[model samples]
Target: MVQVKLFDCEHEQDLEEEINRFLSDLEHKQVVDIKYNIAALREAEDEQIYCFSAMVMYIK
Candidate 1:
């Protein structure tokens, strides 16, 4: 069977760390693919926000 896990955070490091921690608890060979995405938005003239996300696909 195939399973999907999603991770999201405002900081890239946080997102990376979360994903790493999750994958570490699983067998490496079971991981099939990892897709990463990012989005940027302007909340004001002088401020910007960033969103980092990842999708992990694996065999369970």
Candidate 2:
């Protein structure tokens, strides 16, 4: 069956690390694709918050 896993982080590197770790623990054949997205939101006049996320599509 097809399944999806979501991973989110404030930093891109951290998100990559987490996804890599999880991918390494699973068989490569199980993973179909990965979608990555980034967005920035204004928290204040001079502050911004960044969101890094990934969607892992795999076969369960």
Candidate 3:
């Protein structure tokens, strides 16, 4: 199994799109049983700042 995480302040849609792109690339490389999640979002130290986190997994 493999795991990956992505963090950004952008919207979930954008993040999901990026993650999908990544998964597509991995699929092209013959990776299988992949899973992913947008686990959390929270405010950063700065009030105007935001944080996003995602997790990805796959089985070799």
Best by TM-score: 1
Candidate 2 off by > 4 Å: none
Candidate lDDT (C-alpha), each: 0.96, 0.94, 0.55
List the candidate 3 regions with Cα displacement exceeding 4 Å. Answer: 1-3, 28-51
RMSD of each: 0.8, 0.9, 4.8
For model 2, give the RMSD to the true fold.
Answer: 0.9
Residue 18 lDDT in candidate 1 = 98
Residues 1-60, candidate 1, lDDT per residue (tens digit)? 999999989999999899999999999899999999999998977699999999999999
Q: What is the lDDT of candidate 3?
A: 0.55
- How does model 3 score by TM-score? 0.44
Q: What global local distance difference test value does model 1 have?
A: 0.96
lDDT of 3 by residue, 40-60 (tens): 434576445334446555544
Write the residue-wise lDDT of candidate 2 on 1-60 in tens digits: 999999999998999899999898779899999999999999868799999999999998
The order of the candidates by lDDT, greatest first, is 1, 2, 3
TM-scores of the models, in the given order? 0.93, 0.92, 0.44
Pairs clashing within candidate 3? none
